[model samples]
Target: MSSEVWFTVLVLLVGVERLAELVVSKRNAAWSFERGGVETGLGHFPAMVVLHTGLLVGALAEVWLLRPEPPSVLAWSMLALVVASQALRWWCIATLGPRWNTRVIVVPGLAPVAAGPYRWLSHPNYVAVVVEGVALPLVGGAWFTAIVFTLLNAALLRVRIRVENQALAGLAA
Candidate 1:
């Protein structure tokens, strides 16, 4: 198979993985809501969804349109980063357990989680997200998609982190 075919398969697998995450997230959201979790950052939620979906779609589109042939070294390195990011993302989810969801929802009176990836960085999942944003597209030699997603994700993360912190603060209060 051509590199483009392989790249398409990889992107499709990632999309399936994302679907799995949404399933987990939806269940977790319900768990939080049942426990009186208050959700913040509603306004940005749609944008987040759109941007992420765009990442997958844009990567596929760019790869096929441009038909870039990245060096084997660059492709392999980006692929490694993509895998690592997925691992880190799942680590965050497992650490948070039922508390982990796509949206920022905090149950009152519960202390913030300080275990797992959180032990090192406050928002380790975003680190995974940032890495994947750049690496996934480049794995398929889609540099334009990588650059655009990275910039947009950075702006979105800025707002997301602020809202999440405030929600966590409310939990502490």
Candidate 2:
């Protein structure tokens, strides 16, 4: 298969995975609400969705429009990074379990998780996101998409983490 074809398949799988995340997020959100969870970062959520969707669209556009030459070594390396980030992303999800909604809703009376990937980094999922944001596009030689998404994502995460911290502080109080 051509590199473009491979990229298309990868992006499609990512879309499917995201749909599955929504299903999980919805269920988790409901569970949190039942326990009096309060969500922060509501304002940033829409922008995050748009930026992520743009990752997919921008990747495809870059591949088709730019027609960047495939470098076997670099593309394969980035592909490996993408796969690694996905694994870590899922680990973050599994570790969070019923508390793993896409929204930053902190359940009262519960301490922040200190297991799995959370043991080391407070926002491991964001790390995976930033990793995949850059890696996924470059895997298909979509450098423009990778660079643009990385910049936008960095800005988004800054606000996201701050909001999450505030929500968690509420849990502490």
lDDT of each: 0.95, 0.91
Question: Tens-digit lDDT track for model 1 on 1-173?
Answer: 99999999999999999999999999999999999999989999999999999999999999999999999999999999999999999999999999999999888878999999899999999999999999999998999999999999999999999999989888767
Candidate 2, residues 1-173: lDDT per residue as tens digits?
87788899999898899999999999999999999888878899999999999999999989988889768998999989999998998999999999998899988899888899989998999999999999999988998899999999999999999999888777667
Who wins the TM-score comparison?
1
Error of 2 at 150 (Å): 0.6
| Best-performing candidate as measured by lDDT | 1
Total clashes for model 1 = 0
Error of 1 at 154 (Å): 0.6
TM-score of 2: 0.97
